[model samples]
Target: MKMNPLKVIKNGVITENPILVQCIGLCPALATSTSAVNGMGMGIAAAAVLVGSNVVISAIRKFVPDEIRIPIFIVLIAGFVTVTQFLISGFFPELDKSLGIFIPLIVVNCVILARAEAFAFKNGALDSLFDGIGTGLGFTIALTALGAARELLGNGTIFDIKLTPAGFQPGLLAILPPGGFIALGIFMGAFRKYQERKAARQGKPEPVHAAGCAGCAMSGQCGAAAKGGGN
Candidate 1:
């Protein structure tokens, strides 16, 4: 199928952002986003795996047995994640230490596996590649913003660069686990409101593609629920 490249890109980044819209990969988003640098590192590392797995899976979709498709996808994602882990450890030791288990944990990251199964398994190679990139970028952008917000409020700095005045007291909660959830909740709410306003302006409901949710890790559950609803 000939998919519009621009639309594919826009869909991942805006229409259905992996983090903001689908709410996948919150583990890393919450855990690693204590600072902008940490968040960016995690994002790029995952993006590398996401793009590679998507391309390889799409290329071999026809040959992979339906029964073993999930296993094969996991292996492919693991390979990419391993490679990414090595590159980060070798060149960016500080970030490697900061991310720690999360780096290796990317192998099971829902965002990567979900895209491989739902998108690459069904789409052409080129489109799948773009989808991976777009999704990766969206994921990266979301983490960066989240991290920046937390860092600024928690540490009175962003990317380790001081911005707040000397007397400014940093919010301890901003850097804690509770803060991540709070920040994410606020972001999700704002995103939904923006979509709603945009739809209203256009005089139509915002378009939601099931394919977007299909790429979510909870797709199986979602599908089952949808079927039950239809019955």
Candidate 2:
């Protein structure tokens, strides 16, 4: 199918971000984002795999049987993930170790699989490549920003470079699991608010969130509340 490369790129990076906006790949986004270096490394590795898998999938989309498409996509994604893992291990051992299983785990990451099913399987190879790059970059940006924030707050440093003044007592929670959740929540909220403000400034209606708490444990309550408000 024909697609605008620029629009695909923009959609993945900003309009439909996999991490900050769509909220996919939260597993790695939260687990490996304790530092900027770790986060950036993970993000870049994932991006490489994404671009590779997207291109391959898009190229062979027509021939693949619809019934077995999921299996084929998994294999393709797995291959790319394996290659990315080895590359990182050979070139950036520290990051490789820090990311650990998460690298290999990219094979099963919804971000890759979702893109394969939603975009690559339907779009041209070139468009799929751009989509992969855009989404991957967006993922990278989110991870790096979250990592930087956590590292700075938790250790008074970013990428292990000390930034705070001497004697600064960093918050231990910022680098811990709790810190990850809090930081993620804060960032997501901030991004949504920013989007809202931007839309307002441009005289556009507020963007309707795609997920809209559908995956939350409290989805039932959320639905009820929405209906109540509507009434």
Candidate 3:
């Protein structure tokens, strides 16, 4: 089956952004997003894992057993995550130190694992690659934006550049973990509202990919509710 590459990429980056839409993988997003650079670093590492794991999983999907698929996916994702951490620690020691434990935590990030089970396991390698790229990019964009917003407010600068006056007093809370949550909530709400308005303008209901959701993490609950609605 031929897949529209643009559509697949757009789906991951926008229509179904893991952070803004699905709201998966928030731990690192909040922890490492105290600055734009940290957010970008974390995002890049996760993206690498996503692409590597998705391609391998899609390529081997046919040979894997249904019962043990999750374990197999984890093993593949772990391998990629290990490689990513090594590359970071060796090449960008500062970033590796900043990310620290969260770097390894990518192994269990719902975004990567969920994509493996939901899309990669069922799609062609090329399509899966694109999906991974899109998803990773989306995650990166969200985190970077959140980090930048927080850093700007807290430090009165963007990515370490002093954007405020010499005597400016930053909103100290914006640089803290609690500020991360506050920024995240605002971002999520704004994105959803924008999507809703766009849908309304197009004369379409809020978009919901029911078919895709059927294979997603929330599938069991969503599927049950769907069935109940039918009956």
In Å, residue 223's CA in model 2 sits off its true spot by: 13
Q: What TM-score fits each model?
A: 0.91, 0.89, 0.91
Candidate order, TM-score descending? 1, 3, 2
Reference-based lDDT, each prediction:
0.89, 0.88, 0.89
lDDT of 3 at 215: 34
Which candidate achieves the best TM-score against the true structure? 1
Give one digit per residue, the lDDT tens place, for model 1 in 154-206.
99999999999999999989999999999988988888888888999999977
C-alpha root-mean-square deviation, each candidate: 3.1, 4.7, 3.9
Off by over 4 Å in 3: 207-231
Superior by TM-score: candidate 2 or candidate 3: 3
lDDT tens digits by residue: candidate 3, 97-143? 88999999999888998899889999999999999999999999999
Cand. 2 TM to true fold? 0.89
Clashes in each model (backbone N, CA, C under 3 Å)?
0, 0, 0
lDDT of 3 at 191: 89
